[model samples]
Target: MEGDSKVVESKPHLGIPEAVFVEDVAKYLKEQGSCTCEEALKKLEENYQKYKLMEVNLLQKKQRLKQQIPDLKSSLDIVKHMKSIEGTDTTMTTNFFLSGALHAKAKIPPTKEVCLWLGANVMLSYSIEEALGVLNKNYTTAISHLDSVNKDLEYLRDQFTTTEVMLARLYNWNVKQRRAAKATTNGSD
Candidate 1:
């Protein structure tokens, strides 16, 4: 029996030299004696090559996504700036028209046509002022609402961070308890 075992051990085998530290796996495969070592090595090499290719692909995707983040942020900033400028221009134009009409109304003599023009200008200015006041109030309200939303989001983010840390601690404790229980069960067996 000892001589036969020696003969078996002397034969070259798949996964033996490469995995010398893994005694249990080596013993199991040696018992099977199914495939040559060269075949297993080739398969492992192919798998490693495929894994490397997948890693490269994932790294490329990560780099591309990182590049996009700054560009998207800049675009968002540009859009916000443009909207602010547009709002200011609109307000200036409205103010200019109102001031010009007021100046003309004051200087012009009150002939029938001039009185009619003055009346129209005054009515239009009043309507514009009313509309502007409503819009200003609405803009203030919108800003307050956006501030509330940002505060809520910040609170939620902090809560989520705390919960994540708590979850990690719980998971570690659970793993320790499970391992202790398994060890106790195995000792009894």
Candidate 2:
């Protein structure tokens, strides 16, 4: 039924296996000695699924990091701008977006401290210098994380290609073996 849902057992996340060469599939089958082609195919299919799932997760993470890095840079820029204007008697004026297509004009009075939202319904006041330091640190960390994610995505793509090639080679080997057996049986008859 399309509406039916099954409860699945939760297991700890499994690490992805190292990619195997296409020729290695034959060695693996020979080592098994009695593993049917069907069995080997099933195992390879499962491994492929694991790699696909991990790749999907990494892509989602990359998308989030791409969006977050820009916002972080923007926040850092605003804080830096404020610091540059410090010690001057000029009030800061800017347009704040209230919602889609609506803007509100705001004038920020000169002050020694600025309030920063720290997420989860909490905000804290900090000196302009302190705010700059915090924003810069956050920006750097996000960039580093994005770089790591990109590297992982590259590795995953390689694994995907390797698994597909292995599957094809194993299937071809199985078909040739079946044909050879059939020919021998017919000749004996």
Candidate 3:
């Protein structure tokens, strides 16, 4: 998606988000300098669609990231609970659900260290406190990433709205000029 749509920020327009520079807007405007009203309208519509596409993609990515946050935070909480039960024979049962249906429960190993699934089919042995630290760090990082994505999405929305407004203004201005010109020409005859 990133390769499919790119918004180059050479210079941002007024009232638009600083993070987004609709270079196409400037390019099209420059091209329309010598073109007719219809041509300028076409250019504005084309540029408007591009920004809209960007907004949609950003929204999708932000939603996916948001879904992951809850799961990651849940894991962090479990590890924190394990940290609380550190020494004593807390007798915790681990449950696994396959395909969101079948459930299997088993007793955790009777040892001070626990196995942590570190992704890519890899598992590592770590003490309860160590596991808590790792999960906490992961949750923190995920949260930070989510926040960044949210901020970007917001800025993208702002840019989209600003561009749309600018295009509408341009269209209205063109229509008014054409109307006034027609009126003056008709009166002269």
Candidate 4:
């Protein structure tokens, strides 16, 4: 099994770019010294909004992948079970759904071939060995993709926290700046 498994590289595009790292609030304000605190706050708010939107998208994708992984595993299991019984003389019979609320029974015959449904109303017949290979490849691919999605989600959550912190810090800095300006005016008068 170890020989069959290969390391799949996660796509780099799945995570946020390095350029978007959370900035230090004080450093950001210092760098933008010419701009007023309100402007810096507005920029920070925009960053927060962008992070929120990305989180929404990633959450949706994660939900879909979570649902799909189970289905892939189920299909793989069924195929493996079928392959296991191929050589045994034990006759297999089972009830199958014909349609909505309709059922029929069919006897299974030992054979080298199996049919696989490839979505979009397509089906293909292959030898048991070939079918197993296809199913295994698909299962591995789905598992790897799910792992990538999960990692991306974790990274995105960190980004959300960082952005929220920056927003709060920038807002507080803005308030302090306003208080200092008001004090100077009153004192000068």
Task: Report backbone clashes per prediction.
Answer: 1, 0, 0, 0
Considering every candidate listed, which one attains the maximal TM-score? 2
What lDDT does model 2 reach?
A: 0.81
Q: Tell how far residue 29 is off in model 4, in angstroms.
A: 2.4
Model 3 per-residue lDDT at 163 = 61
Q: Order candidates by lDDT, high to low.
A: 2, 4, 3, 1
Residues 24-75 of candidate 3: C-alpha lDDT, one tens digit per residue: 4445556657776567667667767766776677677768768877877877
The TM-score that candidate 3 achieves is 0.68
Per-residue lDDT for 1-189 in model 2, tens only?
433432121211234566677566557877888888889889889999989889889889989989988988888887787887788887889888889999999988677788887779999999988988888888899898888888778777888898899888889888988899999999999
lDDT of candidate 3 at residue 105, scale 0 to 100: 90
- TM-score for all models, in order of appearance: 0.34, 0.84, 0.68, 0.78
- The residue pairs in collision within model 2 are none
**What lDDT tens digits, residue by residue, belong to model 4 across residues 1-189?**
554453223335464632234356567767777876678767767766776787788778878878877877876776677777888886567677789999999888777888888889999999988988998888888778778877877777776777677667778777887899999999999
Residue 54 lDDT in candidate 3: 65
Backbone collision tally, model 3: 0
Between prediction 1 and prediction 4, the one with superior lDDT is: 4
